[model samples]
Target: MSTQQEQLDFIERHLVYDIFKDFGPEASLEFHKVECSNGLDGFMSALYTVTLELVIRERKRTEVVLVKFMKGTEEFRESSNSYIQFANEIFAYAEILPAYENVLRTSHLESEVVSNWVPRCYFARFGQVEGLSNGRESVLALKHLKNDGYQLGPRLILRRDHLEAMVGLIGPFHALGYATRILQPQVHARLRAGVVDMPFVSESGKAIFDVLYRVAFDRFYEFYDRQKEQLLKDTDPGFGAAIERLREKYFKQPTQLLEWIRTNSYAADQADSHFATFLHGDYNRNNVLFHYGADDKVDGIKAIDFQELRFSTTAIDLSFFLYMNTASEGREEIYAELLRKYHSHMIQMLELVLRRNQDELTDDRGAELLKEYSFERFNGHFKRYAFYGALVCMHFLPWLLGNEKDCAELSRLFDTDMHGPAFHQLSMDIAGDEANEEIFKIVRHAYEHGYMDEI
Candidate 1:
């Protein structure tokens, strides 16, 4: 094993200098300070921040970059089918992102680069693309967002401004794929064919989800048992049984729907092709970071953890983000506006990108994309597909919303392949916390909307 100092030295020389030399001809790296980092809900990667002190043209400056080494052990990687995840992430950062930015650069309308929405990946390597990796020694480096004043919001906190900022970006994130299809069909085709959403599609993938699902159910039951007495005290004599029956019926629907999705994920329904786009797939407070201005308002955001990224209907990204971060009430209020924002922006991007290539798409033909892609068509798919958002929340929220200790404990257990009674107890504490009211809100929204019935 490489010692920590040796690794830092390698990173500073091989990684940091390569990324920073572009700062200027006179730019020279003094050194880099490496610090480890992990979020409460972060369980997938070994992360670190490398701050480099550089002198550029006689001026001293400090630049911070992030480095992510693959974290899944051989067995864990095999069981999770993370090979596909790693491949997709590396493909996105290395291949897809640059092409997307190129489309914008050649467009008629002014556009921000992909790095504005996602971090600027300085370097990335994974199996099958840049060479080979055995789920180890895979490395990705990127400009650290914290260096740009971005911070992760609380796991359960849902501020409207933050949601709006994120919703605005989701449009362009997916829009780039649409634009690429129109502007660079060959490149788009290459990417669509290359990336695979295999995390939950294979038998091993299904097994890992089953383990997580089992833990969610067990913890909820434990919490329910612990709270049943007081829960009944404030209710009618027969209310306890009524709730127990409802609860049993309630959770099962998502389990069924989630299993259904595992079978039908990334389904390219012809009727919904116009609305099909890339999905961030995983979007929680952990995966998205926000930058606030001096007025304490969110003006910008960045998305990370493209491990679950895939090409799918836009609803998957939209609903997953809103439901994961916003409670039912908050989501319902802004949901329509968010849908409008994403659709409009996506269409706008498509129009602007095709403006110069009238032979490919004319003003009349460009406008037809909007005519063909209607809000009603898009919203209908969202209603049918919104359950995906709820189900992901169900499987993950129990552990993600837990306290710091719970996250650390869960990570250790997950890494060691030891999901035992001890794991159950930690999950019970997480699921049982009285503050976990939002999970019920997610369930109620799905139940009220008949998401379960659709399955």
Candidate 2:
């Protein structure tokens, strides 16, 4: 919608004031432009790399920064709490992550220290313009990881090694979140008030699904029609009856579907809050970035997109990674191994974090907290919370596996009429033999494995 200039203008006005205090006076803008970050990277917002060639101290230097700007149709933004969502992310980087770092640093640990698990956010503000209604004034500027060789792994199904790296990292980091709550309750409460649960369970969060549920399924119907005629018709018969059954059971009637979605999304806010840990909230593949080391192996990883970061149970985060990011093949084959590996990491990290608080939190209290989230309890929690994985995968994989071009086009449609003829065309374009086959496999696996039944 030609809003890049507006975003850049906002950054230009606030750059020196917010970030560059002493050096800004000598620095002059030399060059700047928008770099494309496709829809898969950010569906709810616009992503761009802004390079400012500045003349500082009579020398020319270039600084490349990543930017996330609010994007989506006007109606979608309002319905989904897009403005507030952006504010939530800004809170994560500006307030939450730093407080976490401070907590770990101040802990009386005699062991290693863990860094906060995100890229540095240089500047963040939500809707600071005159009206604040239009989200043009919203932007989050961060240190660009891509410039330093961090890259996104495969889009569709992640390899086993990548999955291992992700679990290994977040497991311990989650412990740190709870550690903060135990060590610094006042700080923890302040941060929680600032962060909002996202995408699925605010007052208006579930309401957006009313419009989106039908739109996505209607697109699926068009995709199914094309597949049946072009491919499945001769290969497999009676597919239509199965599709009709699914539509009647889940698609046509969404009362249970919505309920299942809400309960699993955050687990009805839980009974005892001890079961809750800090969550990456939406820990899908798009939100994770990987770094390959000398042997071409994944040596390190960093997280992106804190828009959905909140405090919740680890069940949904684990389920989202397993279900939404991994391919059906990966999900089926390494699912148990992944779970065990993550539980192991959580155990190790929980011990490490609790030990730091032993003087204040006490051994008896620490033992109780550990008992609350034992591996046995974790397995059962996954059963109930895994439904979140099934729901979001349907939306993520269809767009990601088909084509980046389609996703980019679909992302642009966020600022357009999503139910119009153009959206239908894009939806059709997003369906492919591989994409359709992969997504249906996920749905089939969900049904067969009783993930749907558990909900």
Candidate 3:
């Protein structure tokens, strides 16, 4: 059968037949692709936007759903561990999202309604499908959000307004996870059961990180050499020593540095476990869509791509956005203000969950809860976040700022040494392409604040 035929049969078996039987006995269904693209992120999945046309009772109607299918190549499977990514994404749609909504509904708060903050899934299935020789097909079909007036954020540079809108949306997303944990512990456990630990901690992920870490060390040293005379003149004699220490961390103990990052990245109330949440792990500009209003200003945001979701502290999600999305000048000016805004919304989301359980938060009660999962205390690991930002610039910035041709080269990433001249130049080019200053400022700020003392 043709690919289209296979897809039609798949949809009918999974979705249309059940609904159409009620619409009319003589109903018929057909679907055609409206848009198709290889995923920009390179590893998790490829996308196809299709419109399903249904005719029944002498009338016709249409529904559009975006289908995400796991990349079927062995290269992707081996390099990124596609199975784990697919499992997390499928579990996110099938289990986590529903549990989050249930928590909201039970809370009886203003935010109780299932909002458009995340796309609605029409159908999600994983495991065997008849057609493919591998017999494995993992797919998620969600409502076409663009049809509802959402637009992708700019790829190269994000505006201050756009960054604020993302923080506004993601803050509640993280809070909802926390509220679910407090109010619906059983459901929270179920959600956690579906997610694996952070992938970078895995052996394969660490191998990749090792390469990028070296490149980042070199990138920093190259910057220092370029500014050595000026830096020494402006600061204490130990300025060069500090940079040398950073270089040594990446060169001699890259794995230990990663461990340091992971260890301090989360906090625990007692022993063994940290305050955890379902994270939108790849929370960058491309993964977020904005809904615009009368003046073409952003009114709201909808986050996409949950393949990287993991159970982690709020700081992981919060810091990823701050580091990846905001510019240096703007980030320093609004850093504390933006964090406060996110923390405030997090509290509001938790309040709604509290209301659902007939537990109102008095000032003392709120203070105690805050102390238990203190935003300020948790975020005190700003150096870890800054470290993560620098590392991403070593690798991700190239792809983020690359053209289609550049992204194609990324598909062969593991075959090449990331610290080699070709890859190093690519990183430098992307950094010089208006991306380096922000990361430098973030790292320097961390040093100035003594946030790196723990490491």
Q: What would the TM-scores of all predictions be?
A: 0.84, 0.79, 0.83
What is the TM-score (0 to 1) of candidate 3? 0.83
Estimate, for each residue in 124-199, the C-alpha lDDT of model 3 and write its tens digit.
7777755432546677777777778888988766876887898788777877887777767788888878786644
Candidate 1 runs further than 4 Å off: 1-9, 38-42, 128-136, 199-201, 204-206, 217-256, 259-269, 433-437
The alpha-carbon lDDT assigned to residue 323 of candidate 3 equals 65
lDDT of 1 by residue, 1-455 (tens): 23345446657557776678657687887877888787644466667788889988788888888887666656677666566677788878888888887887776444577767888777887753222232245568888877678998866757888877777777777777877876788988888888775543334323466566666655555555776675446444444554465456645432454545543444554566656666676766678888889899988888888887777766677777877777656666676676787777766766566666677776787777666666677676667667777656655777656677777878787777644677656655664565345665665566555454455
Scored by lDDT, model 3 comes in at 0.63
Evaluation by lDDT, superior candidate among 1 and 2: 1
Off by over 4 Å in 2: 1-3, 22-43, 46-48, 52-62, 72-76, 108-116, 127-136, 197-208, 215-273, 421-429, 447-449
- CA-lDDT, candidates in order: 0.68, 0.67, 0.63
Arrange candidates, best TM-score first: 1, 3, 2
Tell me the lDDT of model 1 at 85. Answer: 76
Question: Which is better, 1 or 2, measured by TM-score?
Answer: 1
